[model samples]
Each structure stands twice: as C-alpha cells, then as structure tokens.
Target chain A: MTRTFKIFAKELRDYFVSPIAYIVICIFLLITGWFFFSTFFIYNQANLRTFFTLLPVVFSFVIPAVTMRLFAEELHSGSYEMLLTLPVKLSDVVVGKFLAGAAFASLMLVPTLSYAVSISFIGDLDWGPVAGGYLGAVLLGAAYSAVGVFASSLTRNQIVAFITGMVICFSLTLFDKIAIFFPAAIVGVFTQIAAGYHFENISKGILDTRDVLYFFSVIFVFLYGAHLVMQEKR
Target chain B: MIHVEKLTKFYGSFCAVDQIDLDVSRGEITGLLGPNGAGKTTTLRMLTGYLAPTSGTIRINDLSIDDDALAVKKLIGYLPESAPLYHNMLVYDYLDYVAGIRGMQSRRKAERIHELADLCGLSGIMHKTVGELSKGLKQRVGLAHAMMEDPQILILDEPTSGLDPNQIVEIRDIIRRIGREKTVILSTHILSEAEAACDRIVIIDKGRIAADGSTESLKQGSGGEHTIHLSLLGADFEEASRAIGAIDGVSRVERVEGANVDELRLRIFAGGPDRLREKIYACVKATDWIMVELTQEGKSLEKIFRDLTREV
Candidate 1:
C-alpha cells in the first residue's frame, strides 16, 4: 500500500512537471465554466443540476486526455521495463496511476465549487443536491479515469488511447439510452451497466450504497483489466 | 550468489532461450556475450523477474525467483539497455522518486542521493531535466537509479551500447568500480567489452552457452592452434596461399587484404602450438619470394570467440 502511494506521488509530480496536466486542467475548467454560466443565464435557477449534466460530456474528453499518456507513454518510452523490475507489484503501479488520474480529476473539479458559491449568493439554494452533485462529479471522474487508464494500457499510442477511452466512456454513458431501441428484456441489463444510470441516482442528493458501489465496481473492473494487461507484458 | 537450472523460455513455438544452466558466485562480474537474437536479454529478463521463464528454477542464495519474488527483486538493481527514464523529470526528482519507491527514509534518501550524485559524477547537472542531458549523462543517471538501493547483484543490459569510445570507457570504469563490492551480470555483443571487464565470460549463441571461462583460460583452451603471419613482396597471393597450405603444420592459409597493393600478407593457421616460423621460412626460401615480415601471432580473444560460436 505504501509502495502504491509512492508511485502515486511520482505520477502526480510527473503531471505537474509536464504541460499535459496544466493543459488538461485548463480545458476542463474552460468548457465546464462556459456551460455552467450559459445554463445559469437561461434557467436562472439556484440549483446546479444542469451544470452537473454538462460535466459528463466535458469529462468524457478531459479524463481521457489526462489518462492517455499514463501507461501508453510508459510502454512507448520503455519505462514499463524499469517500473516492473522494481520490487513492487503490478497492482501497485495500476492503482497508483489510477489514483493519480482520479486525483487530477478531483483537483480539476475543485475550482467549480465557485458555481455552488455563486448559486448560493444569487437565490435560495439547497446545499444537499449541490454537495451531492460534486460528490457525483468525483465518482464520475473516478469511473471515467479508470476506463481511460485501461484504454491507455491497450496501446502505445496516446492518440489511440485517448480515442479508445472516449469511445468506451461514451458508450458507457449512453448505453442505457441506446438500449431503449433494443428488446425490452435486455434494456434493464444495459441500464444497470451504463454509467449515466448510477450518476443519475447519485445526483439526486442521496447517499445510496447501491449507487456508490456501482461506481466502485466500474473503477475496479477497469483497473483490474489494466493490471492484467501489465502482467501480460511481463 | 545465483543458480539457474535448465532455464527455458519459448515465445509460442519458437524457443528464445533453450534449457540452460549457470552458477554465479558473489563479487564476480560475469558478461553474457552473444549476438543479437541470441537470448541474452531474454535470459537477463527472466533472472530479474521482468519476464517469466517457460520452465526453469532460478535460485538466489536458496530463495527461488517465483516464491520470494519481491525479496529477490529487492536484491537486484537492473539497468536496462537505452536507460529508459521519465524525460520530463529533473535528474534529482527522478532519483528521488526511485528512492521513495525503495522505501528509504527521507533524510537517508537525501544523503544517499548525494552519494550517488557524486559516485555517478552527476553533481553539476542534477537540476537539469533528463530530456536535456546527453546520452552519457542519461546513462549515469540510470546507473545511479540502479544503485539507489545498493543491491547485492547488479544487472546491466548493454550498458555501453550506444556511447562513443570515451563514454564507453567512463561507463566501463564505473562498472569495474561497482563490481568490487557487488556481483554484476552484464550482457554485451561487443567482444572486447566482455574481455576487458568481466571476470568470467559466458558466450551464448542461439540460446545456449557456447563457452564459459575467464579470458586467459578461453585464450589458452582455444590457443592450441597457432597463427603465423607472413608479409611477402615477390609472391603472388594465390601462389603464396597454395604454398603455405601445402606446408606440413599449416591447416589453412588466408591472404589478408586491405594492405599495400604490391605486397601480399598471408595469415597461415597451423594445427598445433608449435612454431611455424621455420617451416614458413623454408617454404619461402624454396620459392622466389622476399619475406618482408614473419611474426608468430598469439590467438586473441576475438579468435577464441569466433572458434567457439562460429558454427552457431
């Protein structure tokens, strides 16, 4: 566990040293901030429900960009050889990189707390849904980044990683809706696996174990897949 | 100390490393000499636990590589070829990250980083990003990375593959210095590199050991044959080669080209260690030839390597 944290720290520091982290943070804030204000002008509501809605689309792009270089560049640069030879488990490297991407996503969401603050000043506001929306934001980030890390592990090209991550996340985000076109029996099954279904349940200002576990499951499955890919290299 | 028994690795149906056995004692620099695609890297990778062998037992001081992998890995410091590193990181930051992973306390890590900085001659460029440094500096940083934990065994894969002559000398000097305390296993295709640095040499060809011994012993073992080089001025290349081949002790004669056009240099391979100078001089006296140079050449390590691995 401690070794995992050490790798986590190194990857986080790598993001800061390179321009990727800054560019990712900038793009994330820019698109989300534009959507929040544009929605606030038309609805004039104290709630940030629409603001939370725009985030999935923004994160679908930002999260992949953040995680694209994680494993892909390591493999391409041959640093995977160096990392594996260390006295650390493959799980450590996978979890460490996953946490780094999730942490960056959470940090990228920190500035958007101003949306909650500004909404509070404008009119009567319910803190429950606003706080729940941010919690949901983090959960969504963790899930998206997991898929991103897994996609990055599948190839050595960052562009391929990014595109693959986008496709997977988009499918997961819209699968349940697309399933409406399928037979009624399988619709429930697709609804259960779609990320939007769980994000919707959490965005309702409730702390439900089912919704939290759903997100955790998504994070686990992808991270475990990434771990298997790394082991195959060994 | 390390013991490997019948280590084998196959990529699908193709055998990259056949069943092979080796023993390495403490404090000896052993070089795995082989041409490319000869399973040198594959062998080292399995030993370091970077790649799992298809079938084998690798025991380091009685602990198998599979059972106690983390423990075995802790005892090994490997520097892969090309020295892959995080180019975005400063030299100090990268070393610090490596130290952190090794579980060193921060204060001790700082002190040890400084020690490695001095040892690797990386004092001045510690703050520079790794991407900005030259190939030599990157290799030095990689050396420092592998030495961070001060492991008992050091594995280097082609440590001086891409360096100029001067850089090669510097890296080889560091390897020699490190070999005094740690058991080192380095792989190289450069024949002279193995001859110059290794205490023992294991020449691998086509995934098997072709020869294993110290430089002197290999020379002596293959040195049973003698070579007599004669530079003749008045003899034709074909006539001199045929005449030398006809000598009693001479097994084969090769005309050494790339010399002065008017002169022909003949390297005659003899059957035994006996001096072929007199026989060659007699043969020359029987012919209308001027013997400008006649010197008995000792068998070099290059010759020994060729003799051992030529068929492979």
Candidate 2:
C-alpha cells in the first residue's frame, strides 16, 4: 500500500510540475464556464441544471486530456521498463496511476463550485441538489478517469490514447440519446448502461444506490481493464 | 548469490535467450561479453525480472522470482541500455522519488541522496532537469538511481556505452568501487572493458554461453594460434610467403601491409610450438635478407571473441 502511495505521489507531482495539469484545467474551466453562463439567464430557474447537463460531455473530452499521459508517456519514454523493474507490483502501478488521474479529474471540478456559490447569492438556490451535483460530478470524473487510464495503457502514443479515451467516454455519454433509435426492448438496456443517465440521477438530489453502483462498476471495469493491459505488456 | 537454470525467452517465434544456466556468487564482478545481438540484454532482462522466462527458474538468495518477485527485485538494481529516465524530472526530485520508492526513510533518503550525489558527481546538476543534461551526466544520474537502495546485486546493460573515454573511465571507476562489496554484473561488447573491470568474463553468442572463465583463463583456453610479424629490408612478398609457407607447422604466410615502403613485411601464422620463431630466424639468416623486425603477437581477447562468435 505504501509503495502504491509513493507511485501516486510521484505521478501527482509529475502532473503539477509539468504544464499539462494547468493547461488541462484551464481548458476545462473555460468550456464549462462558457456553456453554463450562456444558458443561465435563458432558464432563470435558480438551479444549475444547464451546467449539470453539459458536465458529462465536457468531462468526456477534458478528463481524457488529463489522463492521456499517465501510461503513454511512460511507455514512450522507456521509463516504463525502469518503473516495472523496481520492487513494485503491476497492481501498484495501475492503482497509483488511476488514483492520480482520478484526483486530478476531481480537482478540475473545484473551480466550478463558484458557479453554485454565485447562484445562491443571486436567487434562492436549493443547496441540496447543488451539493449532490458536485458529488455526482466527482464520481463521473473518476469513472471517466479510469476509462482514460485504460486507454492510455493500450497505446504508446498520447494522442492515440486521448482519442480512444474520448471516443469511449463520448459513446457512454450519448448512449441514452441513441437509445431512441433502438427497439423498445433494448432501449431500457441502453439507458441503464448510459453514464450520463446515472450522473443525472445523482445530480437531481436522488441518491439512488443503483446510480452510485453504476458509477462504481464503471470505475471498476475500466481499472481492471487497465490492470489486464499492463499485465499483457509484461 | 544468484542462480539461473535453463533460462530462455522467446519473442513470438523468435528465441532471444536460449536455455542457459549460470551461477553468480557474491562479491564478484562478472562481465557478460558478447557481440551485438548476442542475447546479453535479453539474459540480463530475464535475470532482473523485467521479462518472464519461457522455461526456467531464477533463484536469488533462496527466493524464487516466480514466487517472490518483489522480494527478489528488492535485492537487485538494474540499469537498462542508455539509461532511459524521466527526462522532465529534476535530478534531485528524481533521486528522491527513487529513494522514496525504495522505501527509504526521510532522513536516510536525504543522507543516501547526498552520498550518491557526491559519489556520482551529481551535486552540480541537482536542480537541472534530466533532459537538459548531457548523455554522460544523464548516465551518472542513472548510476545514482541504481545505487539508491544499495542493493546486493547490480545488473548494468551496456553501462559505459556511448561515452567519451574520460567518462568511461569515471563510470568504470565507480563500478569497480561498488563491486568490492556487492555482486556486479555488467554486459558489454568491448573486450577491454570486461578485461579491466570484471573478475570473470562470460562470453555469450547466439543466445548461448560461448565461453566462461577469467580473462587469463579464456586467453589460455583459446587454441594456440599466434602470428609472427617479420619486416625485411631486401625481400619480396612472394619469396617470404614461399619460404615461410614451406616450414612445418606454419599454417599460412601472408604479406603484411606496412606504412614503410622501403621494407617488405610478412606475417607468419605459426600454429606450431613456441620455437617456431627460432626456426623462422634461422631461415631468414640463411638468406641475405636483412631482418628489420621479427616479433610475435600475443593471443588477444578479441581473437578469442571472434573465434567463438564467428559463424561456421
């Protein structure tokens, strides 16, 4: 466990020391802020429904950009051999990198909280759903972060990893919308597998065990996929 | 102590390391010498637990790598070719990160880093990012990283490759210094490097152990094929080749290329005993040719290496 933390600390420090973390956060905030305020007065509903609605789409792109270099850079640099030859296990490497990506993805949500604080001052804002929205955002970020890490492990090119991660996350976000094209029997299955659907449930102050379980399962499946990819590399 | 038995590796259908057995005792600097693409790196990779062997077992201090990989890894420090490190990390941070991963305490990590900085001459570049440093300096940082935990075994693949002469000497000095108490295994194609730094040389070729012995023993074991260089002032290549080729136990006589145009040089491949030189001198004395130089060349490691690795 300590070994895993050491790798986590090193990866996190790498994110901060390089310009990648800052650049990714800047782009994430700009897109989220622009989309949220542009539609804010149009609704004038005292709630952050527009921001929550666009969060998954924005995160689908932003989280992959944040996690693209996790495994790809190491593999490209040949530092992966050095890292693996050390007294560390494959689980330690996978989990440590996953946590670092998850942590950075969640950190991207910190600046958006001002949207909630500012909304409360202007109108009578219900803090319940706003707080729940933040919780759902974190879970959604982590789930996508896992997907990003897995994608990064599959290739040595960072651009390829980014595109692959984005494609997977984008499909998950758009699954429910595409469910309308399918038959009624499978439409329910598509909706159940859609990440945006579960994220919407948590954002609306409905803390369903099923929704939380869905996000956890996504995180688990992708993280385990990353572990399997790394194992195949060995 | 390290023991390897019938270790082999196959990348797809191509075998990189064949079934080879080796045993390394403590406090011995063993040099894995071979020509390029001779499976030296693949063997080192398997021994360091970077690549899983197809069919064999590795035991270090009674711990099998398959059963206790982390435990075996803790005892070994490996430096891959060219020292591929994180190019964006500062020297200090990289060392500290390595020390942290090695499970050193905070205070001890600081002390060890300081010691390695001075030992590897890295104090001047502690603040510099690794990518900005030159190859020699980067290699020094790699040395410090490999020695971060002071493991019992050090496996270096082409440690001094692509360095200037002075940097090669410096790195070899550090390697020799560390080899006094620890088991050091370094691979190189340069024979002089193995001759200088290693107590035992294991020559590998075609994924097999071609020869294994000390430097002197390897030279002695190489078949006695010595060359005698003869420079004559009044002689021609044809006459020298005919006269020397007729002698018993003289395998071949060839003209030697010489910078001095005034003298004709001939090299006699004497496969006979040590007294072949006297017989050659007698034959030259019988003639009126002036012998400017007549010297026998000693058996070199390069010759033995070529003889072993050359294809039939």
Candidate 3:
C-alpha cells in the first residue's frame, strides 16, 4: 500500500508539472462554464441537471485527452522498464495512475460548484440533486478515466490511446441509444451496458446501490485490464 | 554470492539467451565482456529480475528468483542499458521520490541522497531538471538512483558505453570505489575497460561464455607464445630469416626492412618462453652484423581475445 502511495504521489506530481493536466482542466472548465451560463436562464432550472446532462458528452472527449499519456508515454519513452523494475506490483502502477487521472478529472468538476451557488441567487435550488449530480459526475469521470487509462496501456502511442479511448467512451455513452435500432430480444442487456444507463438515476438525487455498483464495477474492470497488460509485459 | 544455472530466455521461438551457468562471488568486480547482441544485457536483466527467464534458476544469497523474486530484486541495484530515467523532475526531487519508495526514513534518506550526490558527482546539478542535463549527467543521476537503496549486489549493463574517455574514467573510478564494499557486475564491450577495472573477466560470444579468468591467467593460458623482434644493420633478410628459423623452438620468422635502408627487422615467433633472444644474439654475433635491437614481446590480450572469440 505504501508503494502504491508513492506511485500515486509521483503520478499526481507528474500531472501538475506537465502541461497536459492544465490544458485539460482549462478546456473542461471553460466549455462547461460557457454551456451552463449560456443555457441557465433559458432552461429556468435551479439545479445542476443541465450541467450533469452535458457532462457525459464532455467527459467522453476530455477524459481521454487527460489519460492518453498515462501509460502510453511511459512505454514509448522506455520509462516503463524503470517503473516495472521498481519493487512494486503491476496492480500498484495501474491503480496509482488510474486514481491520478480520476482524481484530476473529478477535480475539474469542482469549479462547477459556483454554477450551483450562482443558481441559488436566481431561483430555489434543490440541494439534494445538486449534491447527487456532483457525486454522479465524479463516479462517471472515474469510470471513464479507468477506460482511458486501460486504452492507453494497450498501446505505446499517445494519439492511438486518445482515439481508442474516445471511441470506447463514445460507444459506451450511446450504447442505450443504439439499442432502439436493434432487435427487442437483446435490448435489455444492451441497455444495461450503456454508459449513461445508471448515470441519470444517480443524477436525480436517488442514491441507489445498483447505480453506484455499476460505476465501481466499470472502474475496476478497466483498471484490472491495464494491470493485466502490465503483467503480460513482464 | 550469486549462482545461476541453466539460465535461458526465449522471445517466442527465437532464443535471446541460451543455457548459461555462472557464479558470482561476494565483493568481486566481474566484467561481462561481449559485443552487441551477445546477450550481456539480457543476462543482466535476468539476473536483476527485470526479465523473467524461460528456464533458469538464479540464487542470490538465500533468495531464489522463482519464489522470492521481490526479495532478490530488493538485494540488487540494477542500471539497465542506456540508463532510462524520468526527465521531468529535478535531480533532488527524483532521488527523494525514489528514496521514499525504497522505504528510507526521512533523515537517513536525506543523508543517503547527499552521500550519493557527492559520490556520483551530482552535487552541482542536484537542483537542475533531469531533462535539461546532458547525457553524461543523466547517466550519473541514473547511477545515483540505482544506488539510492544501497543494495548488496549492483548489476549494471554497459555502464560506461557511449561516454567520452574522461567520463568513462570517472565512472570507472566510482565503480572501483563501490566494488570494494559491494558485489559489482558491469558489462562492457570495451576490452580496455574490462582489463582496467575488473578483477575477473567473463568473455561472452554468441550467447555463450567463451572464457572466464583473471587478466593475467587468461594471457598466460591462451597467449603463452613468445615473440622476439630483432633489428640488424648488416644481416640480409633471407640470411637472417633462415638463421633464426633454423634455431630450436623458432617456428616462424617474419622479415621486414628496418627504419634504415641497410637494416633488416626479423620477428622471431617461438614456442614456449625460451632463450630465443640468446640464440638470435649468438647468430648475429657470429655474423659481422651490428645488432641494433633485440626485444621480446608477449602475446597481447587483444590477440588472445580475438583468438578465443573468433569464428570456429
């Protein structure tokens, strides 16, 4: 666990020191803020539903950019050997990088708190949905981060990782929408596997165990996949 | 001590390292001398547990690479070929991070970092970012990082490769200092470095150990023939050659013109370390020739190395 913490701290330091983290944060905040302010008066909604509604699409692109260089750059630069030769497990590296990306993406959502606060001046704001919306945003970002990190580990090219991650996130986000085009017999499972399937429920101020479990499950699967790739490299 | 038996590594069907057996005693500087693609790096990687072998057993002290890989790794400080490093961080920050992860206490970590910084000649660049440093400086930082934990065994793959002569000497001096206290194994293709720095040399060719011995023993065993060079002012080339070649134990006599037009240089190759010089002197004295030079030279290690690793 201590070794994992050291890796985690190193990755977190890496994010702040590199320009990629700053660029991702600025782009996410600027676009999310512009969209929220542009549509706040038009929608007349006091809560963060509009922001939460736009988050899935935004993260599908932004999170990939953030996580693209996580493992790919290391592999490409031959620093993967240094990382593996350390007295640490493969899962330590995966989890540490996973958390670093997830934590960075989740922090990008924190600036939207002002949107919730500004809405309090205009109309009656429901605290439950706002809190639930932020929780849902973080969980969703963590899951996407895991997927992006796993995609990065599959290849040693940053561009390839970015494209692959965006593709996976896009398909996951809209899998439910595509289910309507498919036969009704398999629609149930297809709908269940969608990216936004459980997000809506969690964004509606409902703390359901199944929705929480789904996000965690997705996060673990991709993080474990990255770990398996690292282990195979040895 | 490290004992390796039947060590092999295969990349799919292609064998990178064939079956090899070796022993490294405690506190001895062993040089793995080989050309490129001779599996020196592969062998070192396997020894450090960075690359798993296809079929092998490496016993370092009481730990085996099979069940106690992490323990074996903990006992080793390995600098891979080219010294891969994180170029983003400052030297101090990088070493600090490594020390923390190596489980060094705060006070001891600082002291150890200071010690390595001085030993590796990195004190002046401790605050500089690794990306901004030169290649030689980067290699020094890599050495310091590998030594951060003070492991008992240090496995370095081509540590002095791609360095200038002065940098190579500095690195060699540091390795020599460290070798006194720690068991060191450094790989190099440079024959002089192995000859100058190592206590024992293990020559590897085409993934196999061609020879392993001290410099003196190797020279004596494989390069024992004595060759004497003679320069005479008046002796003719054919006459000198026939006279020296007819002597006992004198097998080959090579003649060339000396620096002077009238002088003839005869290289007398003889078996065993015998009194060929006395016989050559007597022959030159018998004739009215002026003996300008008489020198006996032993077979150089370079010649022996070529002969041993030569194609069969």
Most accurate candidate by lDDT: 2
User: Candidate 2 at residue A27, lDDT?
Assistant: 89
User: Scored by CA lDDT, what does every candidate get?
Assistant: 0.90, 0.92, 0.86
Residue B111 shift from truth in candidate 2, angstroms: 0.8
- TM-scores of all models? 0.90, 0.92, 0.94
Per-residue lDDT of model 1, residues B239-269, tens digit only? 8888888878788889898559888888888
Poorly placed runs, candidate 3 (over 4 Å) = B223-226, B231-239, B256-264, B272-298, B308-312
| Candidate rank order under lDDT | 2, 1, 3
Classified by CAPRI criteria, candidate 2 counts as medium
TM-score of chain A of 3: 0.97
lDDT of 3 at B293: 89
TM-score of chain A of 2: 0.98
A1-234 per-residue lDDT for model 3 (tens digits): 877888888888898998877888899989988897798788777778878888898999999998999899998887777666666667778888888889888888877788888889889999998888888889999999999999999999999999999999988888887888999999988888887877888899998999899999999899988888876766
Candidate 2 TM-score, true structure as reference = 0.92
Ranking of all predicted structures according to DockQ, beginning with the best and ending with the worst = 2, 1, 3
| DockQ-based class of model 1 | medium
